[model samples]
Target: MATASETKATRRDFLYVATGAVGAVGVAGVAWPLIDQLNPDASVLALASIRFDIAPIVEGSSVTILWRGLPVFIRHRTEAEIEEARAVPMADLKDPQRDEDRVVEGHDQWLIMIANCTHLGCVPVGEAGDFDGWFCPCHGSHYDTSGRIRRGPAPANLVVPPYEFISDTVVQIG
Candidate 1:
């Protein structure tokens, strides 16, 4: 038979073990959410850079592609469009950016920019503005062929996302 002191000691040991297990569970419960919060969400992680082939886009035509849940306009500008954009003086523009600055060095025919209007985030219609560029009908913001804001309430030019011509006919955008 066990003495009273021995039985008391066993009970005390069991209490400590049970308490430690419960504490560990509590810590895990609290730490899981904290640890998980540090990781990026699924959708955010999926917003990586995307690529496009420029072979299909014809001159004087535009195509809208989705990048990071936003519309990106890829325009194959005609010679006339290129000339018009290049001829504009910086003083005439509301958002004064040079046409040459907006395009790739050797590939002046390709004009790539985000389609969202700088005024209020509206998607502009292609080749509909006075400058033959993009027109945001929602707020009357007009962008020139080089995606510079020509007229309207928009405070800035159309955004040009980071892009590189991986090949002569392929572009990667981020």
Candidate 2:
């Protein structure tokens, strides 16, 4: 037989305990989403770096691959193509060749550039000898074989991304 005062005290204790439990659960529910947001899902597919085998790209041929979600152009130049690029005088080009014209160290034949046009971000199709370079059919922008702006509305040369030769047959573009 509990007294009235004892009954009230027990009820108050139980109420405090119930209130604390609900508060903890509510806090946990809110905190759970925040914790989940902070952690990356292990089941999600990771964006691994792509590697291109350059052996199949014969001299005078070009290959395009997606690198970091951008189209990257890898042009393997033949001796004649290299000569053609070198023969284009800087004064004749809309975007003249500076020391920055060359990207790779000690490799003059392998030209890597972003395939997007500098003007409107359109992908320029390589036309080989039509102009000895890329031709953007979108707006008639012409880029020389070295990716320099040769003609049209392109304000600058094609972008050159960082690249490295992993092996004789492999090139990594990032």
Most TM-score-accurate candidate: 1
Off by over 4 Å in 2: 1-48, 98-100, 128-130
Give TM per candidate.
0.77, 0.69
Candidate 2 versus truth, CA RMSD in Å, comes to 7.8
Task: Give me the runs in candidate 1 sitting further than 4 Å from their true place.
Answer: 1-37
**Residue 141 displacement in candidate 1 (angstroms):** 1.1
Candidate 2 lDDT, tens digit per residue, 1-174? 976653445788989999999999999999999998987555432323567898888888998987766788898877776677778877887878842355576667788888899999999989542568898889889877688888899998898887788887887775
Report residue 171 deviation for candidate 2 (angstroms).
1.0
lDDT string, candidate 1, 31-118, tens digits: 9999999998888777778889999988889899999999999999999999999999999998788988888899999999988999
Taking all chains together, the TM-score of candidate 2 against the true structure is: 0.69
